[model samples]
Target: MRGRLRGIRLAVPLLLSAAVVACTTTVPGEPVSQGRVISRDQPGGVDPKSVVENTDGGEIDRLAATVVADLRTYWGERFPETFGKEFTDLGGGYYSVDTADADAPEPPCTDSAVEVEGNAFYCPTADIIAWDRAALLPVLKDRFGEAAVMLVLAHEMGHAVQNRTGAGLSERRADPERFPTILIEAMADCYAGAFIRWVVDGNAEHLQFGHDQLDSALTAVVSFRDPIGTEATDRGAHGDAFDRVSAFLDGYESGVKLCSEMTVDNRTFTLSGFIDAGDAARGGNLEFGQIVESITLSLNTYFAEVAGSGWRQPQVRETEGQPACTPDRQGPVAFCPDGAAVELDVAEELPEIHDEIGDYATGTLITSRYALASLAAAGKPVAGPEAQRAAVCLTGAFTGSLFQREQQFLSPGDMDEAIQVLLHYDYVARDVDGASVETGFDRVTLFRKGFVSGARDC
Candidate 1:
């Protein structure tokens, strides 16, 4: 039985913001006004007239609509043929709200709610889907890729599918013990994969997932897993990495039937289970390895046949350089041809900026690059000594205020705020070199300023 619990809050603001954006627009082929996007922040605050200016909201909504439409079409056709019942249209809505609005009444049949720490979730009670775009989307873009936005939408939609079949809420409430928590979450993962397969298989128009794109999707799925082997059911809303990948593979291979086959009793665990079991064995618990290995090997064999040999051990080759060595070729090292030395320590030559900034500021590299690119694109003079470049990059008028605000405190809320400001600035500043000089900031100069400020502060 899947664990029965009240829907977890979708507290991640970025994700909710993204979902708000996604729920506003219609799918490419579908009519546009079918769904409405609500900024939970602006429940009554989201000006109806401002919808036109809500470009991000619109983009997210449109993308979500596309995914929703595709799912409807795929299941509409498939479900009827398989089960003799037309797939019910689970309407979608996006809400960005505070705690007060979160508990407010929801739309019928399908709705989702999103907040700062809550992440994203689908509510069966309201039959609505909600996400915190403010919390999730930015992280998705930074950690995964823009395509990960779609993966998120797919996950929520999987919940909607569960609602339609009455599998999600029922099993969650009634038979949780019969269905291990992992299997239930794995089913949703598989459903997400099925949607991806539908898109990549060309069943859906203009939606494609390339190999690189698939890697992004795979990464997004894998990141949700629990690293520890403890089968603590209540906390396992999503399966671990290996299980996620395999569940996705199950959908991609055998299609929807594989999803239908997932039940409380006979579900598979992740490949990492084998590794964990192996560790337990070395620690004198051979039974653990034997038990886990049998399950993993069996699942691997099944998926190998279903998804073909390629699914058994998908190879990932490095595109820009040799997989084993970075460009410098230093041991922890790289070969430096310019220095004409096989063992020259390039690590020393590389700037010690990362070390100086500390782990908390690790994302500064991306921020610096983006700031520089924006400034250079806008014709700002960024070239000079390293110190000059860093200064120019760090102290620009646009982001300087943000940096100041961030430096004032270090609470969890403050840290999150700082990260959002930096990430937003970085995302908008990407590839500014192509924009008109009058329009964009000078990327190089801006980066140099930022780098200097950061260095000086350190």
Candidate 2:
């Protein structure tokens, strides 16, 4: 994983910053972008060109080629009108490499095939896009599905779009502030979001997306976000997960025009590469034990305000093995009405999940239970559809508190972890009957409401 991380730096396009305004209008009649909507008619993957090699007629290359083709078509038509200039297709075209093949030919802008391992990138000087078909695509496909792969390609093509504008590598080097790397990366991310919207709208000939895939695509994009605490001004900065998602959402909700209009003045990113000695010593994350204790104290303080003076801190019980809550309230963790306590299967489930996701995943689980307690204290039933929604909303509220940098600090990747858990499982969103929000799309939207506006919104 570390090696792959290192290769990412090598594979990505050189960086730049930008300045622009938000576009208020997009396509006709489609004033608002249709977020998380899938196309009714599916246009399968594209045909592979001769530049792609080492494929035994596999679908991955065809998919990449198809996405590339559609992207060029979208930009080719949209770019001229948006920028008042002719859009240029990648001069060097697309190249697919089988990094696993020792004898495989190296792609342009690379010294060796190994450089492409676990990565994909676009070379501005050469005006070409390339990928490690054998390594990167398959891994992303397995981890986040094919939409992720499309997103990667789309993001790179976004870079090509940037080059077509006036902010290519030479322009960025000329004026770093005018085209900083973070802003440049955000623009690409936004462009990818816009392109994905095009696909979702059934306009593309070879790509399709739905709400579930949208969540997964967001997940994949978050995974590639610069590490938490990375400064927006850093040379390699690509925006924090929050900033990246916000940009993507802007494009999805608005359109390509909004993506083209993004500027540093209008954007806010939470990640800061610089940290004080105290935080540096902790490596941007608290241990599992410390996380539990700190979150427990924080939740008690927060809900005290929400539930009035009557908010009672539930007794936290950590049991071995998986939680064995009654079928009426089944989940990895639970808030027991009978005992007025929160129960966690800490020994294996909590710790393992924490390790798999991050501290915030556990934090989200525990906080959701606390949310139920808050509902109960406020004279609200903890066993209805509304209660379920309230629970998820309160979890978002707590997450918002963390976002505000309250008593409990959010680790760099914590928000992304919260997003992952919410989308991956419904344990935190469930009601007494083990029912919760049916779609990750709605679940994340509600969470975002509380996260952006605070508990009052919930």
Candidate 3:
């Protein structure tokens, strides 16, 4: 089961659109909110005879039961086919703990009820899964909605699956390099992805997600990602947002076999701990002013290497509000071909974003404009749908450079900020006329390609 040392709070801010594109993008269709994906109307309480019968979390109990029942049904059919053997149900059964009550019973792996606060885990030895319904589930639902609770429990079930398939604790610890904590965590995330696909395909008994809800569900997944700067080799390592989402998307798109095939050799992680003293000194963030200066030079250097002598570096113009442009764009950042320059409202807009999201968010904006410039250097159009897609793809390529430790470094939480911005606004991935060409899913998928394959691929 996935575990956490402390409670993590993910506070997402409002998204604002920026810029104007030559032709407006086809806004993606959205799903109407129909309350929770896993409705709290299940017939039986979650593990009826379990501790939940004595607790006050009836709504959560119903949701948990619905998800667990569906999870069991899915694995019951899939596991036997995958392993050529029958799946074994957990004998120790499911459990819930009221972490807030001192008199509540402790889980198998813990000494006291309070120890289960803010956590959920699957104990392989006892063949049971436990959760702090009072503390963990409520807080997760509040921050990320019911989808998160489903994800957490599904991840725990993934651990149970591992135990039954010979890849248990002994296997995990026996070969730390092959099955490190991070990779193990990623596999569970991938399994969760696989299970989510079953639900998305209309196969689950009690849950269904619409297009927009799945997008929100992806946001929920992002929130559970490991803290930035956590090394992949660390004992408690889960993964950086990019790595975690990549694993989940892999399973979501490809299915269970992909998750089962994961290994340290095959899987790549962008998550990093402290690289050196300079990083430690800065607390994994570059100052806003410093970021602008550093990124401009870096962008020019990168494009020159990729586009050769034809590459003409755009002059970086700092602005306080919307810059004067053809038909004027809506965002604080704009790319102008007339002057062969990019204008940034660094006075408040850029700095505010930098302070709120992290330096890479500003980096994504800078690189996207530079991406337009790269297209211009190649004699590619900067005003159409292709241009918009290319710009986002190039921004992704530049982001990939951070993983490689090229010039600028990607601090912790940078990827999360990128996802947050992509979901909330469109400015960072817009074209010359200020229109976004892709859905949040498409934008992220294309960016993932560029990130994995580099600028040459873009």
For every candidate, C-alpha RMSD to the true structure in Å: 19.1, 8.0, 9.5
Pairs with backbone N, CA or C atoms under 3 Å apart (clashes), candidate 3: 18-331, 19-330, 19-331, 20-329, 20-433, 20-434, 21-433, 21-434, 22-433
Tens digits of per-residue lDDT for model 3, 1-458: 00010001111111111110000011122322224775335345355344333445577876777788888899998888787888777787777888789988876656777766666777777777777788777666666567777888888888888887767777866876777777777788889888988887878767765555665566666666665667767766777667777877787888877888888889888777766665655556677777777677668888877767678888888776676563356376778866378888877677787777777677788788888888888888888788877788788887777567643356666776676566546776687787785456667767777888887777
Q: Please give the ranking of all candidate structures by TM-score, highest first, separated by commas.
A: 3, 2, 1
In the range 190-270, model 2's lDDT, one tens digit per residue, is 888888888888788666677656767766666666655566677777765566776777777788888887776776665
Candidate whose lDDT is highest: 2
lDDT for residue 341 in candidate 1, whole number 0-100 = 18
My TM-score estimates for the predictions, one after another, are: 0.47, 0.79, 0.85
- For candidate 2, what is the lDDT? 0.70
- Per-residue CA lDDT of model 1 for 53-96, tens digit only, reads 11244444445444455556777777776556787764434443
Comparing 1 and 2 on TM-score, the stronger one: 2
Once superposed on the true structure, which residue ranges of model 3 sit more than 4 Å away at CA?
1-35, 39-57, 305-310, 326-330, 337-339, 405-408, 437-439
Strongest candidate by TM-score: 3
Q: Model 2 clash tally?
A: 9
TM-score of 2: 0.79
Give the poorly placed runs of model 2, Cα more than 4 Å off: 1-44, 50-58, 77-86, 100-107, 111-114, 227-231, 239-243, 273-282, 308-313, 317-330, 379-386, 406-408
